[model samples]
Target: MVRAAVVPAIGAPLEVTDIELPEPGPGQVRVRLAAAGVCHSDLSLSDGTMNVPLPAVLGHEGAGTVVAVGDGVAHVAPGDPVVLNWAPSCGSCHLCALGEVWLCVNALSGSGEVYARRADDGTDLYPGLNVAAFAEETVVPASCVLPMPAGIPLTDAAVLGCAVLTGYGAVHHSAKVRPGETMAVFGVGGVGLATLQSARIAGAERIIAVDVSPEKEELARRAGATDFLLASGTTPREIRGLTDKQGVDVAVECAGRAVSIRAAWDSTRRGGRTTVVGIGGKDQQVAFNGLELFHWGRTLSGCVFGNSNPSEDIPVLAEHVRSGRLDLDSLVTERITLEQIPEAFGNMIAGKGGRALVVF
Candidate 1:
């Protein structure tokens, strides 16, 4: 039996409970989690914004040590530190063949499998987002495990699975932000802050960070925002003013809200690009004028996991963390135990902190 924070149903608070862990089946491995980052996506899953089956273990951003492996799993061994890749690629998929492995056809189409069973009623529990790191132990596909280097702290590397990959990938791959380009990022959450730092790494000349809360200003600037503004109706105009009325070359919406998405679109200059990295609710919609799409010549794109190929990108990101190029420390604002997940969710809902890690 292993301890886990399980969401009994949509809109229900997570409960820390024990569950029976099945041994890793073929091509699977059991990970003893060292740390898990409480991401907004987990919140979406719990609140019904993103649909998944009920009574699931909710967490994806995690790092851990492999404790056991099943048949045909040779790439990793027990005692090895690894980061979970929630969207593991099936190399033979059409998307993978085209080098767009981020959209692996089987990425979300699970086999309706259950890796753990409830201790009380023997109810089968789904592993949310495939990795299920809200537990002390989780069984996942061996391919979903990326080996971590020794130097990087497992606690810090936990977020590389999601936030860093998504944010950095959005800037470098989705937007292809160029040197000296002006950039605007809406939201200063984990992914948004990572985007801001990535923009700085990409040599963006003027980086603007927008958020509703005034408390995030210091952290936003530390993450490389040249200017900060409150998210509001006139945010686009303010961003334009900062860029000398030219607007930003790249505008990223990380808030996953309709207004922020529109703000991202409105803040980009003619022929510039706007990338939506947030996973908004299914019912939410962002409106745009039909004529404006053609007249503005601006590109609007959506990024999934930052279009990252986990096997290839995770190591590079780990290197960045080691070399001080990526500031994971400042991004981690708080650390708590596994039992504190509910409080972590509260903080996330209130937008109270940067990244909060459930450290073992």
Candidate 2:
């Protein structure tokens, strides 16, 4: 039996309880997690914005030590520190062939399978996003385990599994913000905060942070924002005002709200890039006129998993972490126990704080 946070059904409150974790089968690995970050996607899964198998373990951002590996699992061994990659690309996929592993179609095919049972009822449970790191222990396919980059603390590396990767990739990969460019990150959540620092790492001349909460200005600045703005209808205008009538060169939306998505687009200058990483619901539609699209000449693209290939990118992030260029510890606003996951979800909903990590 191992402690885990389980979402029994869509729209249900998370239950912090015990579950019977099976040992690694062929092509599988069992991990003992050091920490897991409660992410907005988990909230999306719990509330039906993202759907998965019933009674699923809900965290994907995590790092742990491998305790066991089944046959053919030669890449990792017992005691190896690893990051849980919730979306592991199948090498044979078209996207993988093109070196765009982040868009791999086979990445999440395992989410439909049951890997655990409820301790109380023996009911089947799936591993949410395939890694199931919300639990103290979980068994997943060997593909989901990536060797942790050297020098990063095991607990802090959890953010690298998702938030940090998404943040870094949005700036460096999706938006491709160049050195000395002006960039703005909309939203001050885990991913948004990481993007601000990533832009700083990329040598952005001016890094703007926008959020609905005024309290987040300090946090944003600490993460490398040059300026901060409270979110409102006039946010884009204010950003343009700061940029001397020219908006930011790149704008990344991490808020997962339609307003912020539109604002991010509106805040970018002509021929700039607007990358959207937020997981907004269908009802929250963003509109753009044909003339505006033709006039601005800006590119708007959706980024999944930060458009990151985790196996290849983690090493770069680790190097940054080692040199103090990246601050993983500062991204975590609260360190918590498994039982506090529900509260973390509430915090995300209330638009409060940065990442809340579950230290096992």
Candidate 3:
């Protein structure tokens, strides 16, 4: 029996339960998860904001060793250290064919459940995202697993699947930020910080970091933010001052709040791009004049999973971490077990940690 943390209901703490795990079906692989990062998306799932099915095991960012592979699978064998891709690129999908696998229209295996429930007498358990890493072992599609290079720590690699990849992809792929360009990022959370570092790597002349927390300012700076804004009174004016009163060339919104979205739109330069990376509500809507969108030639874009093509980007990100350029080590703030997922998630909701890893 494999112990798994289950969110039996909505708007509540996750209950850890020792449940049996079934073997992989055809085209699936069973993984012994080594570490899993607690992401904000999972918290959103619990509160019904992310549209995840209930009584689900919540975790997407994970690294593990393959224990078994089902029939017809030849890519990876047992004991391969692999990163679980929450968003797998399906080759047949239109987006995938266009090299935009992150936008793959099919979410069945890329974003939804892959395992079954035995306690309920063979009832299917909806797995959160493509990989539910909060358990000792998870069954996933072969496409969702990526073999990691030797010597990279699984614990650190766990976050690379989501936070690092998403952030890096957003800057590199979504906005195509260039060196010496001006970039401003709103929200200093994990993904936001990753975005900040990517901007630095892209050689942006000025990278501005904005957040409500004074504590995250230093971290953001270290991650390559040249200027920091704490969302004080007259924040727009403050940002305008930093950019010669012209606003930043690119604004990436990592905070899902309505106010943050508006700030991103307002802070972008006349012809700059505003990329929305954060996930928000279905009912939430932003107000913007249609005329300005056309007259200013300003573009408002939304990217999911950082517009990443998992097959190509995941390995590249791992190489960045290996070269010590990505800084995945310092990005990790806490490590706990599956039993502590509730507390770990709570801390994330409070915006108190960098990244939390659940080591199985």
Leading candidate by TM-score:
2
Per-model TM against the reference: 0.97, 0.99, 0.94
Question: Candidate 2, TM-score vs. the true structure?
Answer: 0.99
Residue-level lDDT tens digits of model 2 in 222-328: 99999999999999999999999899999999978899999999999999999999999988899999999999999999999999989889999999999999999
Order of quality (TM-score) = 2, 1, 3
Candidate 1 lDDT over residue span 215-317, tens digit each:
9899999999999999889999998898889999999999788989999999999999999998888766888888999999999999999999888887787
Q: Candidates' lDDT values, in order?
A: 0.90, 0.94, 0.83
For lDDT, the strongest prediction is: 2
| Residue 320 miss distance in model 3 (angstroms) | 1.6
Worst 10 residues of 3 by lDDT: 107-116
Clashes per model (N, Cα, C within 3 A): 0, 0, 1
lDDT of 2 at 51: 81
- Give candidate 3's whole-model lDDT: 0.83
RMSD (Å) of each candidate, 1 decimal: 1.2, 0.8, 1.9
- Residue-wise lDDT of candidate 3 within 1-360, one digit each (tens)? 787888877887787776677788789899999898888888888889977676788888999999999998888999888998876766787766887767777754544553668464554577888677788898889888888866688778888888888899889999999988999998888898899888988788999999988888888898999999887657767888998999889999987878888888888888998999988887668887878778768888998989887777877876777787789867777889888888887776776767888887
